[model samples]
Target: MDTEFELFDDDKSDVNAPPSYHAVSMSSISADSVQCEPSFVFSKAQTKQIRTTVLSLIRGMVITPDFILSSVGPTLDACATSLPAAEFTDILQESNIEGHTPLYWAIVNKRPEVLSAFHKFITAYKNDSFHDVRLACMVTNDHTLFTKLSLTSARLHKMERTLNLSLGCADEIQVYEGDTENQFTAKMQITMFQTRIRVVQKLRMEFIAQGRIWGLLFHVGDDTRWEASIYLSKHSLPARPKALLTVEAQNEQHQVLKKEFKLKEGCFLAASEYTNFSIRTCTSTSASLGSWPIFNDTIYMDSNGTLHAKLDVALQ
Candidate 1:
């Protein structure tokens, strides 16, 4: 049987504790008096000790994995630079009290901090080749029915919410909520056809002359290559029915790379069929569309600062 580590409620829990490279200083107030919580330091030796303790606790089912993960989230972040990925990965793979993997727990519970730590671990240890691990995390043999139900529920809920937000609003210009310059913005994820599509809506971008616009990142087939789409509101500008739609990317030094598409038939820009507008910076290094960096955040402001455009992202 694995030994279970005790949780200390008060200061001096670990009296005479030796110092180490990384330590968490905590304070606790007792009923009788105020007391400083004992500092628990984690060094190389301490890490090994912690690994043994955690594995034992997990196997013994004395403490829940989620609770343990949540408790040590900060520790993981602090040690990310120093700890090897394989070591941390082994630690996280231990099943939780509920028999769920750490990745699944992080995703289902929406534990952003833990999830971030996991991402860092994967990036460092797996070198961005975690697709197989991701697939494994999504599957479990013990609870097929429950997992299927959860997935169905999530999918339906997302579709229902999208439908609610997008109904009767297609092609209509809506003001971006957060700021003044964003007169148009919409984010959507469409997954009906097994295709992952991310849409970015930008309105009145500084470079563009005050018009409702859109951009898309499409991931289809098996390759990492993704195609982009640009669209302009059809009914938007009454006076100027058509205009040149130019999308440009900039380097760190602000050098512009430009691509242009023509707008016609009351539509300033259509899908890639009409023209190809390349936004070079919108590509990602990952094969999975969900891992693509384009969806991270796209907010741009021109030199003069008079006009601005914010990207609204959707993943399908």
Candidate 2:
């Protein structure tokens, strides 16, 4: 009974769902809408043109953040606009003959201001070079820079698919915040990750939202298939009437899969203190494990066997 595990101090849900607990059909689980056309292929000359323009953008010895944000990003955007979405995304992730990408150079050069400038540029298409650029960030040894870029990468992935490859939680933990015009969207990330293997594992990540204390407790051990259980120390304020909880992770194919829980009705019972609301059970929801989930038993692991999980609660 840790006082700081305050979010769900009163939660008493079990690892196994009770007969009274209704397991909603997994209908909402599906791929995010992405229209991929096979016909959008780039010509050899066009690919070379894009690369040449990009390499020239960063050719100068001293690169300024302002130049990168204004000139480089816009120029890159124009290139992407001219091509099909799939082809443009693929080229954005490519390197020049020198074996380096614009992203890799931008980060390695330490132009901190220019990182988030590409947020829009990266998210507009399906770019999968996040983790690769992160490996290049290590040379700077700037944890703050590392953290900012880590968040930028997560934001680019937009919640469902996220990976944080910073040195460790040893440095200050970074929080990614989002809220709607209506209620609130409280997000949590297992910045630390692992792969599916026949072994027991455990981890913890603590974060703050609007000056309140919160945490995610994780346990990885599988009875049948590889399984994991993630528990948030608490839920939204008892005042909020209902909530929708969403959790997700990437798969072998790099597609982000999402599963949600509606915390209302019999599922989310509320009372004066902090009744047995559905969101709490959803929070206490036993993780299915792997690139994981109760959503699907698949987890995204880096070259090293670490797992990454993303959870967010929208109060309604």
- Candidates in order have lDDT scores of 0.31, 0.39
TM-score of each: 0.25, 0.34
Q: Give the Cα error of residue 204 in candidate 1, in Å.
A: 21
lDDT of 2 by residue, 1-316 (tens): 1111111111453233111111211121111111212223656674454444433433321133234344445444544455465655555456531344545555666654455544555664334365436434433433345455442332342222222322343224544545553333444444334421222244444443332223344455555543333233232333222333344334454665444433434343222234443454334434343434323344444334334445554444
Give residue 98's error in model 2 in angstroms: 3.2
Model 2 Cα displacement at 239 (Å)? 48
Residue pairs clashing, model 1? 263-268
Put down candidate 1 lDDT per residue, 238-259, tens digits, no spaces. Answer: 1222112222222265533222
The TM-score measured for candidate 1 stands at 0.25
Q: Which window of ten consecutive residues has the lowest lDDT sum in model 1?
A: 200-209
